[model samples]
Target: MVSWYDPLVLAQTGVRSIISATIGSQADRRLLDALAAPKVEPSDFSVDAAGRPREELWLDYVADMGDGWDSTYTIAQTVSRPTLTLKDETGTTHETRGGEVLVFGGDEVYPTASVGEYEERTVKPWTAAMRGQRPAPHLFAIPGNHDWYDGLVSFMRLFCQGRHPAGWETHQRRSYFAVKLPHGWWLIGTDMQLESDLDEPQVHYFQEIAKRMREEDRIILCLAEPAWLVAQVRAPKERSYLNNNLDFLEEQVFGKKVSVFLTGDIHHYRRHANAEGRQKIIAGGGGAFLHPTHVPRKESELAEGFTQRKTFPAAEESRRLCWRTLGFVGHNPKFGVLTGLLYLLLSWMQVADLREGGTVTWNLGRVLGAALVNPGVILLSALLVLGLIGFADARFGRGRWVAGVLHGCAHLAGALLAFWAAFAISGAVLPLGSVPQQLLGAVLVFAVGFLLGPTLMGLYLLLSLNGFGAHPNEAFSALAIPDWKNFLRLRIDKDGRLWLYPIGIRRVPRAWKPGETAREPEWVADDKDATPPELIEPPIVIGLLHPH
Candidate 1:
């Protein structure tokens, strides 16, 4: 229900982003350490039905959720099911039960993190899905950047406490956690607050965890951001810090034991593997807006020794979706209203009366000249250009400024042209009254501006993304497509093999009706055309690759 294109949402998020960068930078990490809770021991999660250490585990991973209700609930419904039977790409049927442990990788709430947003967007849907389940899964989460906007006070209170958000039990004491899986496997979730380096306390916590690991132990490291993919897209100087932090943790604390890296910041599903069989995956498509997988291109190598193995919504399909940006005004009508108002303001400021031979006419030249001399108009124009520049992603480096300036100019040019066309039309058809001509021109400019403004922006975003690999986040967030949601289900069997099942929801339900019973989900998909979850690919099995 929340559109990223909404002007209010954009404004609020912009302010939060600024505050988090300035004030939060100095205090958040230190506060995290100061309030660090008692760490959860691996033994707490390793127990089996017999109350002894187990040799196998089943867990579910989802992230970047807590957005629109329909999309978020659709994912929650599928994951909360007692069991799911899905056919892989080869038409072979595979059955998987709901995970015993549910891990939310990052960005549990979108736009901004707050108790109300978390309750409505996350808790309401998840709890509805598990209304009367007998044995509920345990919940764990790592804070993403959005969660850190409020210095993680809300996130920690909602998730770190041992409260049950749904039927699921919360057990993690800190923002970061370590869980001992069966068969010498460990699942570690790290909170890299706002892309900063790992806090000292976190490093020490993982160091203590390392002391308990056996030589043959393997780790499934959960990160808030996919630093590997980030390193590929960012400038050279900006790339190394996050990657270096992970490298240090791997080499020193964990002794190079991480066999799989799991993250969800990018909002899609992608798998990459190294020659050594270390797997890196991005499965952030829990419920947030879909992010295109075609970016950074298929040929751009992500990390050293790593090659991309698979991507959901194939690169070609992703490219095709970029074309949908042409429907920006249709998709985001309220945003169009904002653009329309801006155009009206500009048009009103430039309106000039020209009288010759007892006839009044609206002239494009006079209107433009008047606008140039107006101080308010100039200030507004400058702000518009600067705002667009600021909107550019820093990852684009210097090209961002160029893209911003050009994009702003295009909007300005389009507006002027709309004004010219409106003035000419009114002058040709209407009588020579100055007030009537100006009024009609203003209305026409607003109508045309609303349509043309966002349309121009959409075209700019589409061209930038497909042409230069820029604005990957901005381009797609504008569309807010609710489809192609995905999550991961993993099983570490008694034999110590890790089985990964990447589940995809091609289309989320758009309508919902009340459930028939108390045990059923409070809301069920009302549309008979709802699509069932499917396997993205064949089940991926990782055999023991670490040296004994």
Candidate 2:
């Protein structure tokens, strides 16, 4: 698993994100998807039993996986099994088996999407879990932003081809696909690419699928991002384009047949439902860092009449976890090392003579004046201010610039104080030689920087998230909590009723041992350490069995 908090990892991801965004804007990849292969027919996905379309079907949905081995493998193992008997909050038992179709909603691999990453983080673990399983499930995936880092090359090669990633069969001809399910139900996965705009080819592709649908046919629309949740947070002018695209599809393509908006990318489980019985679910917790559920206000609706009904890690628990940011140094020592080095370099650049009449003297004014005059220090300072401003949340609008400036100034002030304190303390303790005092002061400065810099950064992130509703992704990714993971299981019964089971894993096992048999997951959670999965809520029944 990539340590997101590691300074080098953060730098690499940031660069990749910038590059991908730039490339996506200049060259649209979705337009090329049609040229890659012929559009798949909607009827291709109908589940068949005894050479006929079955009236009942079971399907599994997971996303934001391909991280740490233990967490990813744990989820893979659980979902790959033949049967899972779990209990709901009311103590009622529910038995479910692995889905005939496994849909990875988005972000199959983390850090960046590459062939190597997919093989190591996704394919290997899944292959291990599904080894020797019979009647392999059909697999489908939609590309999230991370997957588009490589322009969907790796994503297409892994999922779009009619090849098996593990024991599952991949039948989708393109990144986006339409699956015809039993009882006039359909599963449509749309690839929004980096930008949320759907290409003309994709629009026509779905429109073609729509022509075959009856007026009563309901859709389980799978998306990479939950545009509803995004729309709630961003301003109207800056609202998600994905939501707009869905609106177009609803208005022109499928009408009001979309019953469920299934998505991942948030790395947690949340459900919202409107009065019309339509559901919008975010179940990204396949296997990634846990994101906080408390960031979004309780009173806010995800969409028109769609109020949040369930969350896996309750808001209270999520709020409690925010305190973990205080231990930022322990969580990300490598990041701290970067900050420490930066502080030391800045301090060294501003080091004053501090020698007077055979005694080491501390002078803040002298150090500040020296730093102000130094061209290198001035340039570094400017870069620091600009970088911090750029790092501020864009959602904050102009306020982000103000916040970033203040934040940068605070760091500069803190660095100055640290330098002064280092010299003062060293001068007071060390003997009267200028060289010895300077050496000792430099050591103290580095020590203080290493310890205090990251702690301050953590506090800043925590305050930004809690106080200003900024840096939600950064704050939680820093924590890297592996618990509170979840996924979804959907079953369309013979009666045509759609049942959704949201399963939650409170804690993933930290230890693993090799399985002795081929039928078992190659790496099984140690029996003593295993935490069984349970339903986050009772099964959510969507749409009437027989609609008028």
Candidate 3:
């Protein structure tokens, strides 16, 4: 895990001063001037066959789009999602298709941002998917947090190269770029500072770009992170780094004019706007596991210029926040024991009466009540006991039951003492309430239940299952089905009007399975019987997306 950081960042502008003086302030005035020049000759990033730029440029895009574990569960949409030939809502069968220019918002590949990962996760899958195409769509991308995880070296090699891995020309010179489109439209994308601060180079680059563009020319801004997610869920008003960059771009650079704002990273589709018409459209469902679309419109904490227009697979008002946090915890059961142990460690130093509840002589009623619950707890204890038994039996003979019991008791005593000391210090000021105490105890119980392995967990899931999260079938105890996985097809027509098509997919395309090639699904151009594209209703208009 060698990283460029002096291991970690120094601060906002503290240690970053070195990077700012060196790389950020590199002498590139000649290149900047040339790029910013008006009426520049077209290079490889060309328009249609006629070489005459058309007024309308079609941008088909996806984001948060890479498989965590190969392609089966997460990357199916990435590999298999071709515009199926199907009957529209009117029942007339036709080829529903995608745009010509393919745009990737960010997080093109996942797990890590290494070059090898890009090759396996994005390049190979996309190249395979290119089998049915003639001239591939113009490919462009910006770096996400995952991409920056490896210091943008992989990002530059895969994306900033002259040609992409799939043999498509990537005309973007920098990780952050400005694409000159027809009809006075500009596609501006910037590399986010890994959700902290925009680097000085990026700001300087955009400033030069602003100096070059016409005052009236509009921009379709591509941002790396969706500030709304962090702004709403993680922090109230903090973690607005992305939005702060947006404001800087609009007010300081672009003079408070942005035609539209596009972002990814939430793994769901959301369209937000306000009365003034500025929109924030999140299309992170390129290939990652789905994020729940259950956040209520009213509960959304949008800025002055943004409000929720629609979220597909319409959902209900959210439940209590605590339950939601628990659901997130249960999504990956492998981590449940560690999380539960932490909770258990915090439980040792409760009020005296809470632990020793009975009088001097315990009633038979209380004893019976304790017995009923003790069996389950006793079974959980056996796991620890067996571990000690295994260790002692390996060293001593099977007859050494006394040694095993003593070892188990000794380990338990040490654990209890450590937990007691930790909890004593914390609970002095924590004031942990009754509900939190009960919730932690329940989590510990569930963790023990899961420790019985998948068979028992599966059986418990049937009786106590709530729904799934992270993936279509990954069980989460509190949160229900994660409903949204989608991509957007944005078009700017001859009339200079913007159009948005957010299409939802129920399942991902299967990938890297046995007989990997032959088992692959073909792109059907005339399958009207397949799952028809779930086109969200009330076709979105350009006015709804434009700058106020």
Candidate 4:
């Protein structure tokens, strides 16, 4: 099991954070890459497909792909993406074009905050994916938070090195990069520096790219995190490096010529659009724990110029969106069970009494009093109930108290509900002649609460109604919690119409047996359920882009 407290991981992250702070991530890249780094690892690269340049470009994009590659997270955390990738490679992708340019949006590995993990998680698998292609497509990548965890050490090595891995070329040297497509299409991808903010150097780097762009250049922007995550405060600018830089790129670089905004972080697929028809696509389903796509957001609208375009299992409302992929996943329940046991042990240790006669007595109230002992519980609970006024009071648009209240109440409610249910059920299982039936009831309650560990925590975090980074972002996640795992296929046809396909996962393509060609997966999607080979064009605000 991968413990977050693993000595090596903590040591690497702690050390890397200090180093990154002192010198910045990119400068360190330049220094460490002196021997192999190119003099000019550009912010963008211009590409012509098939040696005959066409204005239109075709590309495939995916992100959040570092988890589950080898079941390294079986007992440590959730593992889904790697298996999903295998499914895609082996079968799910049989019907789609793999794109001439396969861009790895970001996040090469999970818990990948260390350089030591990149090779095992990202380099080996992705290189094989690229190299195994009949005529390998060009591979480009950006650094996600996980990649940044190592200060971009492993990211630069895999993508910046001149040599081909498994024969697939990765030509960029820096974390942020762009690919100049034909016609007026430009694919600009940025790196969200640590804590989701871009530093001064990163700002200047994009500024240079912006200065070189034409007033009329249309951009296909890539961001590490989705801009529309917080439905309440969607200004196209969140208080983060990625969002701030996106603003600069629009205001300064291409002069607001952004045509398509693509991102992957939320571990599900969503196509958000505004009334004007500008598209913001979230296709984080490359391989990770599935995030739900809640239908009706508490926010009247998700955000300014943002609305859910389309999602699978299109149910409405957040409450209906809970219980995400409850089963049918390979997640190990051992760690969760262990956690439950730990909670029970702690509760027992805190309240168990030993008498001189070697008798033991249980104080149930004391056992659960970690919560009741808090002086602020009543104030916080009242604040949570009254804070609903903020929903009515436009004057106090948002405040920390509102968030804290909502979170506290939700947690309390979940705990109470869980404890009550467990006590009721466990109490029923006891004999009436028991010396103290409440003791057994209390132990069972503790067991149930801990066993439902994440479930309770997820409930608490989910109730943060502020919509400002709610743990599961009630908007995109809440109900109809399907494993909306997927990737995006963006193709600009010969006539320059851009087609965006959100390919939802069926199953990881089954592994090929001996003597099998990579032509198809062992099990293909049934025709009725199969995603159409060619995607329909999404409505765009700026100009007409249609298939010929």
Candidate 5:
């Protein structure tokens, strides 16, 4: 369990300073450029004091929407271990002093978010983390792609008041809701399923919210997935939010210098500069599986500097704020390579002493002679060896060739070991017909049956589970295990810039521009073809996502 990484990072004299020297100033240029864009044509788009789109009105007035409410609250209340703290970028501990809201990205349950999924996988762990915690944060969330797998009913019920014990619904509103925060902060939450259109009622609700923002002083938007991050990672291939013209909302609100966005789902934390000098925080790493660390694309940075697309330079400036900090930090702890090597060495030592440790001695010469004379035992052993090898190959191997070889060896070795053990035990014991002898025979047979059945069953499952004509790669690929507990958390800062703090790492990547990574959806043939959707009705109200 020796850790090598601890010293490696500690040896550096603050890599942040080194990285900054190599890069330039961290100011956002995009926000400055955007301020020069045309002024808000309020008449062209009917908006309320809040500046929310008018087509989306019903959602604007939800119990959560207001100057000081957060409909979607994202809480990283749980820790992977007993020692970790559930804190925010400001080191505000959430273990007891709960925030008012919570948000989710996707895969709330590891692989898929099936109905009642949380009951089996996450609810207990989450509850354990909050046991006796003083205050509890209200929860709100949106459906990510993983959440969409089982149609989100399970997720909706767990958070929305449909089930209990095995459920986590703390309120009555559907999974996604908007809450108005104090001091003109309007928190808008929504599903990231861009393919589906917002229902007419919901659309109107959001529009009315936009109208209100026009009159408001500030707004923060909370979304499960950081559409900005997705745009950077999967540029030219929009994930969800970006596909729905959320970028356009950024452009409209850029001059306001008051809107901030809070997002999660990438499983990494990031802080980026908004074109209007606001902060965009990505708090996606909260006990969940970590994602690849990313750098801003060169094209994005060159096209619009650090404004819309946050570049590394902007991150350097972000760190100077001093309010940012991590709730927790961890490493794999055990060096996997070293651990594997030690285990292998121990296994080798055990195998070397196997013959000497066991008090059994076999008359191999006589047995071989007998086997040569009859040949049946040898033939049976050969067949068993082949089966054992096949099983071994499946269990230990990776690709087709290695897997086949290992399985074949395993089957052979298992049969030989069983035969030898049974033979030695039989030779040392009494003949059958006695009470003790019969009992021993029964027990031995049962043990052998138990061991052999699994070998046989495993081979059968391997063969039968794969559909005809399916590639072995595809069949075996899915059999690989996946980590079920990848919890991520996100939070937004006061400046509207995002600060992403992964639970495992203290250093975060530099933020990218809003549109630098913005990609036109696949449905849109190309970037040029990806025009803002034409509005037929009175401008739909879309509330700005509030930073929690």
Candidate 6:
């Protein structure tokens, strides 16, 4: 059974383990320094008397991947939270308990390889709650696109161990590594750097590992970004080298049968059956921003034995529209004045209709049809976004929108489109007379207006609301609940890979006091759905150790 844990905690532990390994006998000394190191500490937060946090951070989901992290590893952790179960082809169901050995998919930090960045953004918040947790599971990690943002200096210093003299430059002992588990299970991890010709050593190294796996019953291949998933969405040239149909190498080079392939990167959750009918899962939903939502496509659905869960049953609110501030068109006289163009685009159908026709033509029937025909595209784009949002929110608290104008717009659009499609099809059965033609046009207009009207209204409201305050003034208020008892819950999209809602994670608990808002233990399936240990901020790394 594959058990997933919090990504941030996994990254923190990986950094801790690597540093501990690198410092060797001085591991204790280095740890002492890390604990005592003086640094800027982000403020501790709590909900107001009404059960809402005074401050909440806005996080952007990762989309533009870079060279990627050095390595990705998947392990299990044993926490008091709960357990989830996954059944193999043999009808053997394995339960995944919380707080198991953590897995690392890659790009634990962002923009730079600075230890401070990782510690501040990921570690500090994570370790705060697990302070005295015992028997922390072993850690494994892989490189992601962003980890290479600063030449991977921060990653190497924080996570590498058992290295060669040439250091990480050599392929044989780079980021890719393995761990033999108690069962016949073998944990195989890899680095996404292979796309930039960073896998020569890893490829060779894995060949030997795969050969050894020939004798195992199942192999858990770890990846920062799901390599197969990328192959499904990316152009052939844009595909990562790590995904060079390496599974084919199993029979040819390793003389073994590969069972499961694992990956992360998009900060979501996904599980599928590979070409060989083996299981492939994407479990990146550790402590990161929830990804956007998407519908599944056809090729992905058509793949032999392919099954995806796009929407969760519980998160009906997700069916609403999400308002994203695209860009601010300021008056820059130095450049060609473009603010005037915004008004023109909104008013003129010829200019905006085709450009945004994708949305205009975005009928649910059409989208689902497209998904049935081309699941690959859907898998690449929307599924990633939807899975990320659904799973992340299930574990952590952050995403929730007001059921207002935005939702009204989405609902209106979907309804109108359904009516339009139904009526338009009636023309074939009924006579194609004046009545049919007029009805078609009317349906089309209704659909258009239903979708666009609320969107336009929402824009107007935002504009008005923003104008209500002066520059540097904020209009949006915190929506946090002061008590854990008041916490809202959400689910994943149905018809996607997971094909379940709330994706098996438990409901978020409400806060204790009216003015005190904090997350209770997650409702994992095990431990009778016990409470999470404690509430603390994540860790932050402040320094780096260069080449050994």
lDDT of 1 by residue, 311-401 (tens): 9889898889998998999988988999998888876666543345775545767667766888877888889999899987675687888
Better of 3 and 4 by lDDT: 3
- lDDT for each candidate structure: 0.84, 0.84, 0.54, 0.52, 0.37, 0.35
**If scored against the real structure, what TM-score would every candidate get?**
0.94, 0.94, 0.62, 0.66, 0.42, 0.44
lDDT of 5 at 400: 39
Question: Which residue segments of model 5 deviate by more than 4 Å?
Answer: 1-97, 162-169, 194-200, 232-244, 251-258, 295-299, 302-548
- Stretches > 4 Å off in candidate 4: 1-52, 69-96, 114-116, 127-133, 199-205, 231-243, 274-277, 295-306, 312-321, 324-338, 347-455, 458-469, 473-482, 506-548
Tens digits of lDDT, candidate 4, 1-548: 13332336446666766766554544644334433543433433344535666755556787776555422111011111111222232243323355667677777676655555666665555543432234555777777766775567767767766556545577676676767776567787877655566554555656666666677677888888875564244333344544556676667656767777888777666777776656788777665555656522543455555667566434343335453413211132443454355344433333323222553333344324543554444455456356433322221245555655554455455444454454445556765225465577566756664556545444443444223333444223323222345677666656556666565543342222321445422222233432322121232224554211
Q: In candidate 2, how many Å is residue 245 off? A: 0.8
On TM-score, who's better, 3 or 5?
3
Predicted candidate 2 versus true structure: per-residue lDDT over 169-195, tens digit per residue: 787878898988988899999988887
Clashing pairs in 3: 65-287, 76-509, 250-256, 273-307
Number of backbone collisions per candidate: 0, 0, 4, 19, 124, 91
Tell me the lDDT of candidate 2: 0.84
| lDDT of model number 5 | 0.37
For model 5, state the Cα shift of residue 454 in Å.
24
Runs off by more than 4 Å, candidate 1: 29-40, 298-300, 353-360, 365-379, 393-398, 546-548
Spell out the clash pairs found in candidate 2.
none
- What TM-score number comes out for model 2? 0.94
Note each model's CA RMSD in angstroms: 2.3, 2.3, 14.2, 8.3, 20.3, 20.7
lDDT of 6 by residue, 1-548 (tens): 00012234335545654553444333222233223332212112123347554332110111111211100000111122244344433445443334233445676654334667666544443333333333233344566655654445566655554332111121112455665432234556666452333333445555665555435334556656655545554445655454454544455544444455555564444455534445555544343322322322333533346455332111222112112211111111211122122212222222122124333333445534443344443343344334333322111122212223333334334433443454345444655334664356444454444334334333433342332211110111001101111000111111111111112222222222121223331111133333332211111111111100
